[model samples]
Target: MKSNQFKIVIDDTREILKWISHISKWFFPLILAKNIIQATLPYIHILFGYLILDGIIAKDSSSDIMKNLYWMIGLNLGLGLLHSFLTRLLNVKTEYIHHATKAEIARKAQTLDYEELEKKESLDLLRRAEEGINSNGGIPSFCNTIGSLITHAITIVYSILLLSGLFIAAPKENATVLERVFNSPLPTLLFFILFASALFLNFKISEQLNKRSYAFFEENVDTNRILNYFGGVSNNYNFGKDIRIYGMADMIQEEMNQKNDAIITMMRSLGITYGRYSALIEIVNQFVIFSVYIFVGIKAILGLVSIGSILKYVGALIRFIGAVSSITIFYTQLDLQRQYLNNYSLFLNLENKKYQGTLPIEKRDDNEYELEFRNVSFRYPNSPDTVLDRISFKLKVGNKMAIVGRNGAGKTTFIKLLCRLYDPTEGEILLNGINIKKYDYKEYLQIFSVVFQDFKLFSFDIGQNVAASIDVNEEKVWKALEQSGISERVKKMDRGIYTNIYQNEENGIEISGGEAQKIAISRALYRDAPIVILDEPTSALDPMAEYEIYARFDHMVSQKTSIYISHRMSSCRFCDHILVFDKGRIAQVGNHTTLMKDEKGLYHTLWTKQAKYYN
Candidate 1:
């Protein structure tokens, strides 16, 4: 087994390489060229300055100096224009990468198995990934991290080599203050070591500061989770009426203020800690710059180099010091960025258990299919209690089944297993006399059209919403809407079946509760799958609308095997079989007449209590 530390290390390494490949493929070569040109510009500027100075100081005609000055001005102007153009290209590249990377992550969330969404660990990883590079501190962004690393590293190395050549003495000269130190190779080496060491220390300290800044988000995830939930509730249109009538606005704001206080405290602490890194860097820069100036001044006094050379050496040394510091700091930032990448990579690698099957659900004229749950048991991830214990049942071809149960009696869990949203913890589910896992996960899903209690409607055209595709058949869409009893309302709209289902403009359609429920039913009908499951699809409708559906339930379901779940026991009279669930077990299974006769059974007791109001 791999250790936790080892696993984290591997995840970070893989993520870095993956991002590098993506960024480099688009802009690495161009960025490298830009860096190379930018790197040479400083040295060229220094050289031109020295040549102009030498010409001016040589006691020659002023024409020579004028020519050198003109050349220097031309070089500076050309370099400025080039830098501006390259900077714009860099912006365009980084922005494109940012958008593309975010879209890729969103796509991954959409494709992930539904079961993974329930896991806390998966959700936490997803949040950290969303916080993304550089949002909290120095975390690297995928689009620009590689380019930055390459540019900084190249600049530092080339500056070091260029600065080394300046150390070689010209000749012996008249005695001057501190001339011995400038001529001594050992002193120069000592100063170089001190400058490099101080710069490294600053970088090391900054990286830790950056890591702590981002750590606040992960540490307070639970608090932020509640903050986000209540915050969203305040903005939700569905909760607007409740917020006003119940006077919940002030209450939610107080809760948000409490969470905001925690965020403020964390940021304050991080800021105080980061202040120390800045102080240390400030001290290092002062010492390094002062030392370089004194050494260069001594060389000039000793007549080892001209006045022009002195200016060149001092300017180059100052810039060289900055380049070295920047490179070291860039590396430290990359290290911190890798941790965020590890979080993203772990989420991307989360287990996916779909589509292990080779077989397809066969096409049949009569849509003949059979399903059986063989001693199936299930418990949610990280839960100890079984949600559905040893559940066994069968739905033969063309047989309608009704599941009756109180809340938390495992009705939804049973449907989830049948649809393979999750697999049973023990035993198996079989379709067509074989284990259901042997069939293509998507193909198996195609066998059923389930209208869940919490169905959602999108703001799309009526036909696309019903058909689940943009390339929809208008004829079938109308036929399905007609069967669901919503055709008349849809036909009266300005665009008929092509009308938008939600308000966008003056003529856009806005549906009532019953109309929306019927549209949901239309969506199920348009799928035309082999099996139909309706989990209280008509709960939102009026009694008359509900009666209209019950009256045409046979025509709506047609020959397809149907499963209906409802609190109203009267609905069970329409089905061939009723399965009564109590305390995660099937307490009884029979027709309504047979179950109602047994006074001791859970269903009979429930039926008697509910039947009182109607009687």
Candidate 2:
């Protein structure tokens, strides 16, 4: 147990030092100065008081007393100013460190492999790390705990220095044997033993309290996640309509209440246990104080120490015990905070298993990126079933292809593989005769622009959302918006392309579903990559509207490769090539004219069924 505790202290201390060095080189120096000044402030005042009493007893000159008085006041005032200034600087640095830590976490999360983002283990790890930063004060808590440890340690040293005379002062020759024993160095050793015992008791109590508190934090992760989800739903205006129309308010409230009740019960139980431990610590503290008084009083009675010495020893001993107790408590709390930092470090260290090839993609002006899925297959992580099985296909430059099938026909999985969101579990994907994995992952992704079925737009301004960047080109954004058929609606807005998408701001306006889809399409268009993929892009639009958008997009990307995915059969008629998927394989591949002739084919069957609805 002792070894493990020491190991944790070493590891956590190293971690804190690393962050302090990385975040701000001056953070440690400033914190050290601030803690030193804070800890010495009270000691200085105590020492001055002791000096004043001693001076008066010794019949010091009135001028000398006044000088000492003036010096004390001057030093205290100056130290106070320095302490405040350092504290302010530390606070600013602390906030910067906090924000920097959060940004690092966010950056790591964004750079994670798409597959990892979907894995349950990775998701839980991310949540724990984020909760540590967002809710638990993260590195700031480490800073504060470190400060407490330093301040208390300095206080302990100063107190021991002031009280050293109490134990070291020689016994008078006329003193009785018992009084001599009490005044000898033996009494000092015994007092130290007593103080050590008191500290030990306090340490044990503090360890117990920290354990309970950390356990509560661990237990609350899932509870807080659920409660936050519900809380978000209640606050989100998007869910307002369903909640009111379906009378789900009671259900959500009931779920929230249950989680809240469980948390409250746990908190109350923790409070009770903590109260008992605190009482025990306080009892130990008082006992130490009483022993200090008795020891000092016996020395005073023996005429071995002056009246001023008794007061100084008593005061210093009290401060010493208080400092020792604080050190124990803060050490335990620092360890608790270390566990949270460990979680954060674990998340940052999660390896990206996906190969990020170092080879740069050759820049081409002809937009001649050829892609092929050669016997590619994949199954989701931890799933027994393959989502896409032996999916073989090839794409020529500027070829317009339509992928059609019912839901769960591996259509979206095919797109995901083509986009290299997940590498094939078997076989390989090739780009321009070279394995796609050989090309730089980021550069390879730039070959295509995809508008997925469940695309999302942030609450940024219209132009920003369309361009997916802050540095938007007004000409390109307006062009993309016009091509996606939302330019007129945007032009009518008070802020035009600068207007926010949702009610995230007072001037922001909620857009219709079709309008949002158009914006998503506009985002895809703004990229103007060699290949454009529309995956159920027009699902929210009517059949006529869907056909119109597809028709305009088809012309807009006539020179570039395009892949259209839709349930509406009318959209596929304009495509030069079509691929029909069923289960996890390509069931059919041909053009609209050739595939329509085979009435028994999946394409013919789906087209005929959907055609009846439109007719």
Reference-based TM-score of each model: 0.91, 0.97
> What is the TM-score of candidate 2?
0.97
Question: How many clashes show up per model?
Answer: 0, 0
Which pairs of residues clash in candidate 1, taking residues 3 or more apart in a chain or in different chains? none
Summarize candidate 2's per-residue lDDT along 1-615 as a digit string, tens digits.
899987978886797678658878888878878888889888766887778778899999988878878878998999999999988887889889888888888898899998888899988888898887655577766777788789999898898789778777573667678876886678778877988898898888888888888899899999999999999999998999999999999999999999999999999999999889889888889988898888888878877788778778888888888999899999888888878777787898888998889889888898778888899889999999988889888889889999998899888888888888888999999988899888899998898899999999998999999888999999999999999999999999999999987888778999999999999999999998889999998889988888788889889999999999887787788788898988888899999999999999999999888886566
Pairing residues by index, what is the TM-score of model 1? 0.91
After superposition, the stretches of candidate 2 with alpha carbons farther than 4 Å from their true spots are: 134-136, 613-615
> lDDT score, residue 103, model 2?
86
Q: Among all windows of ten consecutive residues in candidate 1, which has the lowest summed lDDT?
A: 134-143
Query: Top model by TM-score, which number?
Result: 2
Clashing pairs in 2: none
Task: Give lDDT tens digits, candidate 1, residues 1-615.
Answer: 336744664467556567645644646555666666677677767877877787678875788877877877787788768877877886787676667657756777877887886677778778767665435332225324545556656666655665675677445667454665566687668876987687778767766775785577567767777887898898777689999999989999999999889888987888888787778887888788898887778677777778887777787788778777776665555556666665665666777766569898888897778899999999999999999999998888778888999999998888888989898999999998899999988888898898888888888888889998989998999999999988988878888878887665445677877788888989999998889888888888754556568658766675889998877665676888999988788989999889888999888888888775444
Total backbone collisions, model 2: 0
